[model samples]
Target: MPPIDTSIKEHLNALLDRGKGAGAAKAPAASPVSTALQRDGASVDFENVIAEMLGAIQDMETQLSSVLEINTLLETDLNQAKERIRELRQEREKLLSTIARLEEEMPSKRELQMVIDQLIEERSDAEITIRDLRRRDEQVGAVLKGLQDAQRALEDSRAQLQSELAAVEVRLEAALKDCGKLETRNRALEEKNAANAAAIKELEADLRMALDERFRLSIELDETRRALAAMQGR
Candidate 1:
């Protein structure tokens, strides 16, 4: 690209020299329109120089716009790079935190072995207990069956005893009725015996009076016979 300052300076110096030359030379002054229309060499040179300066300015403006566009692109790239670096740093910190946490949480080999051994021992003990309990449960089931059979036997015996007791109670009730009848009969016999005793006493007293009367009669008859024999002898 051409330099803007140099081009402008050269054009201005040429213009100034033309003005000085025109002023120094004694020439008839022409009207502005005539001189412009004449298209003189100096006028034509000045117009061409102005046209070149304007073209140079336009070229400079285009180059300046391109430089600005490139600068803007570079700034965008730099900002993007800075943001990516920041994200990477954050990711690094997170990874370091994760590593530290894992290190703290991880168990030692000895501790893991101890836990495995304890689990094995517990499993063995549980198996032994399960076998013992199963055997005991079988024995208990057998005993329960025996108890149930004995209870059934006891129930049958109780039913038989109740039947026998019912029979004995019936016999006892009949015996009680017979005893009641005997007591009544015995009371009647006692009353009859009492009446017979009173009659016997009265008959004994009558027999004694009859015997006394007979004795008196016999004595009287003997006395009468003795008197009669004495009279005859006389």
Candidate 2:
């Protein structure tokens, strides 16, 4: 198998950290994540995070590829082993056929009996060879089974890992959506505040004008009372 890339794990962990405030524990899956992570002008590095996850998946696929290679080699060895066993069994069949034919045709021939004895000895040797072949075939079968088991385990791991990555992606998307909504709300609030400030400035100007008019009226009244006092003195 290709060496494990710990960087992929590290990247995944980083993305998980970014999603932590997405309130995985608090927020439902379909709901938007926490808007707290969103800065005014800053955005989440979603593309980068997803790219790293894809890289991790690629690494897992590479490991599975190695498992497949092992399975292929084992399958080849198994086929060869079975073929050798078949050849041995065929040799034994041919030997038995020869012996049967000889016995039927020449049972009364003296020299033919000697020939039958030699053929029987050869048949025993053939039987031993076939037995050895069968034993080797069993060993190959066991090895193939072990390789198949390993392949299954790798497949399961890949599937689980992919599922987890999918979850992370969902959370990230939720967080992004939350960020967008927050930024919009914040903008609206800022606009409202600016409008309120302008209204306050107009109110303050009106108040100042009212106060100036009152002061002018008091001054005019004082002047009129002085004129009435001067006319009475005359």
Q: Whole-model Cα lDDT per candidate?
A: 0.52, 0.52
Clashing pairs in 1: none
How many clashes (backbone atoms < 3 Å, residues ≥3 apart in a chain or on different chains) does model 2 have? 0
lDDT of 1 by residue, 1-234 (tens): 223345545745565577578668996545453465466532333434444544554554465555455556555655655555555455555555654554455545576567556655555555657886566556555655665565566556556555655555565555455555545554554454444444444433443343354346445534644564566569
Q: Give TM-scores for every candidate, taking all chains together and pairing residue i with residue i.
A: 0.32, 0.39
Quote model 1's TM-score: 0.32
Query: Per-residue lDDT for 15-110 in model 2, tens only?
Result: 556657554567432211123223332234443545454554555455455545555655565565555555545555555565455445433436
Off by over 4 Å in 1: 1-3, 6-57, 108-110, 125-128, 131-234
Q: Show the lowest summed lDDT stretch of 10 residues, model 1.
A: 41-50
Top model number, TM-score: 2
Which runs in model 2 stand beyond 4 Å of their true positions? 1-128, 221-234
